[model samples]
Target: MVNRTNRTQPLSGRGAGTREAIMTAAERLYAEHGLSNVSNRQIGEAAGQGNNTAVSYHFGSRATLVRTIMAKHGTHVGVIRMRYVKAAGDSTELRDWVRCLLRPVTEHHAALGVPSWHARFAVQVMTDPLMRTLVEDESLTRDSLCLTLQGLGRCLYDIVPPEIRPARAEMARHLITHTCAERERTMAEGLAEPGASWERTADALEDALVGLLAAPITRH
Candidate 1:
């Protein structure tokens, strides 16, 4: 068997374009078949390359490729979330922070025309411990959302106890993840149903998120 780790044969001209094509194809395939099920060869084939080398040349490893796709997209998302946090004007209220954290993701899904595959991909990342670890290690940074989350925790600390802040953050993260998953499922169902609109779904989701995050914080 060919060494799957080897780089794809380099294109003679338009190397950058070829690399981008490979990345795009890999992202789509990974979203469809999942990280575990998809192989480098398959990605190359989808990218219009002759063999698996393209994936290796551009990304070095399967893990890196997945991380790259997420970072390229997720970093932009992080920026949007950070902007919302900045706009909150130092309130640091738990509900406000929660809304800021969630708004960007939900808006992105709404704006991008949520594909059915995105939900499945997100669900896999949410539940898989190894994948989560990889995400933290390779995709996230200290100054990124992780720091922003810590800041949010400090803001919430005024209301919730120190020992429990970690737990609360975890709970909040799960809540957001589940909400997104549910939104995707709703979208999938709505596509089959008559008169389904993303705008309606986004409005309802925003309302539900505010209620979900607000109730707990207000109770404290």
Candidate 2:
């Protein structure tokens, strides 16, 4: 029996290009229309494939296709994160670790330029009940990300009370995901504010996240 999940393994030349096109179309459609709202056939059509089953042929099920896309972007982001992690060294500052955590993502989006769909697409996957686990699992496999997260944890161990850490962590996740999604959407629609460059946005996110992670826990 053939493993459909490994179908993309030997791609090259025209086959590789076709696979890339299908993934690109799927990412864009899933970003614009909700993941559940987009169909595999629609992705095929968007990718210029005449056969509606092109997506299934190339990537198997919806979960596999989504995982493939997430893996692509996640790998890219993880690579960029390693650069930041190296630069951070053994710095104990909370904001340095926060920068290590957030800048890779912002830098990836920034390098992709305006009108890119990845940030919003990631938010779509992260927020969806059925698909969220896929992203979480994907995240755990990234060594650089895990190290950065550990750095953040170490920085927060004394500052944030152990009991409320989980809640604050959840809040930080939402802030990073939704905030970047909103910025991407506004930029795509030409509604971004006067000074909305990715660097400035990253700085703002870094500030907010630093404060959020280090804020005094008020226990009544």
Candidate 3:
């Protein structure tokens, strides 16, 4: 008997490479074309795989494919972020905290070739319910990223209200997300203009975020 479902099983070696190709292409296309607009067939084509069934085999559905992509990138970025966050000593300032939050994504962008449309794509994915749930599940485990956030919270314990620390942390996360979206957009637009270095963008973003997150502390 032939196992028709064998193609759907997890790939390894060269097969793993092929699956990664599909995922990378899907991410690029979905980020470029938007999730709703990009189809399984389109993703397969972009991935250089002739079979549309690869998407089903690898991810089960279009929604799952997008989720997988988000999970891959989000987890990678989150791990790098948590390293910096967890390493900060007792003397970490608000700006150092901001750097820990901001550096991973910017550094990745600098290395991974920042997309011209990533800002808009980020805004969409962050706001989308399905994607948000996927992100929360894949990246924000209590022992992982959440613990890092709690550490930051501890650093600011003297300045922030104990009762509202969770709320403030949530707000800070949103502010970082939205600010990154805007920075990506500004970079996309400003790349053709003068003085568009990633360093400059990172600095400006860090300044803006420091203002947003630290303002409350100053008021207190």
Candidate 4:
């Protein structure tokens, strides 16, 4: 799908620094406070842009800024996931494919370490009616992701109800996003569950997701 042209193109040369700064700051603030609460002026001030209009000049609108951040993280996650997908070639085991689904998320946030903003930012965009479509268009639908879903479908075969597969897939998406966001928030705040780490969380999530996907569908 052709990407819709961004209303505000990021500036080149020295202005690029200001643009990046605003994006980073906006992401952090938006993650800490809900999107509706954060404003362009606050984002501009947070980025240290003396000009109050900095965010307006750089991003045009809040939704545009949100999409930029989602695309940034989505690109990184997609690269790592594609590599995993390649490694899982022809493997029908549920765990092998589930790792492809879960690891990129946990691993990316893990690499970002504490105070990462993308997970929270993602949840916000997903929950919002308008912003959710922007994210799904730019980041969620991709050949690599579709390929992974195909692999999972192959793994489940005739076990899962075909009619209900879409419902189950959506459930899996919600679980991973919320779980990781909460984990990121607590870990950043030093409230992580008793010596827990992203690695351990990934393992636990992998186990649960595998069971969730592979569990037999009970027909009424």
Task: Count clashing pairs, candidate 2.
Answer: 0
lDDT of 4 by residue, 12-75 (tens): 8877888889989988998888889998889999999889877777777788889888888888
List candidate 2 stretches off by more than 4 Å. Answer: 1-10
**Which pairs, if any, clash in model 4?**
none
Sorting all predicted structures by lDDT, with the top scorer first, yields: 2, 4, 3, 1
Task: Give per-model TM-scores.
Answer: 0.74, 0.95, 0.77, 0.92
Pairs that collide, model 2: none
What residue runs in model 4 are displaced by over 4 Å at the alpha carbon?
A: 1-8
- Candidate number with the higher lDDT (1 or 3): 3
Candidate 2 at residue 22, lDDT? Answer: 94
lDDT value for model 1? 0.64
Off by over 4 Å in 3: 1-10, 114-121, 142-144, 162-175, 178-192, 216-220
User: Per model, how many backbone clashes are there?
Assistant: 4, 0, 0, 0
What lDDT tens digits, residue by residue, belong to model 3 across residues 114-193? 55444455666777788877767766663446655665676676766677666666776677677666666666666434
Candidates ranked by TM-score: 2, 4, 3, 1
Task: In angstroms, give how far residue 54 of model 2 lies from its true place.
Answer: 0.4
